[model samples]
Target: MIVADKKPIEEIIDEIKRHTKILILGCNECVTVCESGGKKEVEILASALRMYFTNNQQEMLIDEHTLERQCDHEYLEEIRDRIDQYDAVLSLACGVGVQFMAEKYHATPVYPGVNTCFLGATEQRGLWTERCQACGKCILASTGGICPVSRCAKRILNGPCGGSTNGKCELSKDLDCAWQLIIDRLKALGRLDDYETVYPIKDWSTDRAGGPRKVIREDVQV
Candidate 1:
């Protein structure tokens, strides 16, 4: 899932302070699951902003809405008729959703209301850990399903670096050595021989090195 963290209220206020009317838009997807930007969060932020404006004798019109998703055109179209009512939109979706909304609306200013963190898993309530960098390649099959690109401190593919000691990352004692986890996983799976195999240099073009990326599926086209 795409995990995100709420932006500080002060920074958010600073951005939209000049606007008399604003829309606090939320997403019901990943950001909601992560508890960063959902219906509840939108209400909280809107109320806080309203309080700030009211306390300072500023007349501000702040409204809130949550879409099934901000990334899709269908869900975004739900607000088409009412969109022009606001001076600007404070999108509580991920960075991708904010950009998509801006691109679609074009005329309105769209501001991100949260910091896009990473593609991660929910370890527990209120806790998320990075799992994938979206490097456009899958090395998990060779590494017993552990992702080195995201979990490893140095992103070492071959094996653990000399810096790691006692299965802990050199960067921090609390951090587990990703490669060590891989080795243990492989050992448990009775595939320890796979560790001896060397992986070639990763192709950088498949990653963000080539700028924006896209995938097409003609089968699902309109």
Candidate 2:
């Protein structure tokens, strides 16, 4: 999931402070799962902004709405009629949603309300950790499902670096060594031989290092 953390209220207030009319937009997707942006968050932010304006006698009009998703055109179109009602929008969705909304509505200023963190999973309540980097090349099959690119401190593909000690990462005592985990998993699966087979240098072209990338299936074209 795309994990995110809410921006400080002070920074948010600073951005929309000049606008008398504003909209607090939220998404019911990843941000919602992370408790960063959702209908509930939207209401809370809206109320806070309203209270700020009221207390200061700033004469501001703050409205809010949450879409099923902000990344899709069909869902974003739902707000087309009401888009012009606000001067600017404070988007609580991930960066993708904010950019897409700005692209769809060129007239309005779309501001990010949260800091897009990473592709990760919730380890427990109020705790999330990075899982994948979306490098465009997946080698989970050989690595026993552990991701070397993300979990590994140096993004090593071959195996644990010399820095690995006692199954923990050299970077931090709390961090587990990705290659060590891979070796252990492979051993448990009786596929320890996969460890001896060295993987070739990763193809950078498949990663974001190549540039903004896209995938298309002609068979699915509309």
Candidate 3:
């Protein structure tokens, strides 16, 4: 899932302070699981902002709403009727969701309430770690399910860099060497022989070098 972290309240206040009527929109998807931009987070942020404004002798209209998803067109339509009533919208979704909401309501200003982190997994409660970089090409099939592209400090493809020591990355002792993990995994699977076969240089064109990407699946098109 996409992981995100909350922005500082002072920064948020600075952004929407000029607007009298503000809408704090939440998302019920990835941000919800990450506890950054969910319904609960939205309510908490709204309350904090309300209190801040009240104490400052400012009268602000800050309303809260949570959408099933801000990235989907169907879900975003739910707010179309009431969108115009607000001076601005503070979207507590991923960066994608914030952009989609802004595009859907071009006239209304959309501000991001959270900082989009990366494609990651929840290691445990309150702990999320990066897993994939979405390079547009998956190499997990040959790499024993360990992703060096995302895990390696230098993004090495072939083997562990000399910087690794005792199964830990040179960058940090807590960080496991991506290549070491791959070799261990392959050994366990009895696929150590596959390691001898060197992988070819990855095609750079398939990644972000091409710029904003889109997929056109004819079968799934309406």
lDDT, candidate 3, residue 209? Answer: 88
lDDT of 3 by residue, 88-169 (tens): 9999999999999989999999999999999999999999999999888999999999999999989889989899899999
lDDT of each: 0.95, 0.95, 0.96
C-alpha TM-scores of all predictions: 0.99, 0.98, 0.99
- The per-residue C-alpha lDDT of model 2 at residue 187 equals 97
How would you encode candidate 2's per-residue C-alpha lDDT over 63-169 as one tens digit per residue? 98999999999999999999899999999999999999999999999999999999999999899999999999898988999999999989999978999999999
| lDDT-sorted candidate list, best first | 3, 1, 2
Better of 2 and 3 by lDDT: 3
Question: Would you give me the overall lDDT of model 2?
Answer: 0.95
TM-score of 3: 0.99
For each candidate, C-alpha RMSD in Å?
Answer: 0.7, 0.8, 0.6
By summed lDDT, the worst window of 10 consecutive residues in model 2 runs over 200-209
Q: Give the distance in Å from residue 147's predicted Cα in candidate 2 to where it truly belongs.
A: 0.5
lDDT of 1 by residue, 118-175 (tens): 9999999999999999998888999999999999978889879998899999999999
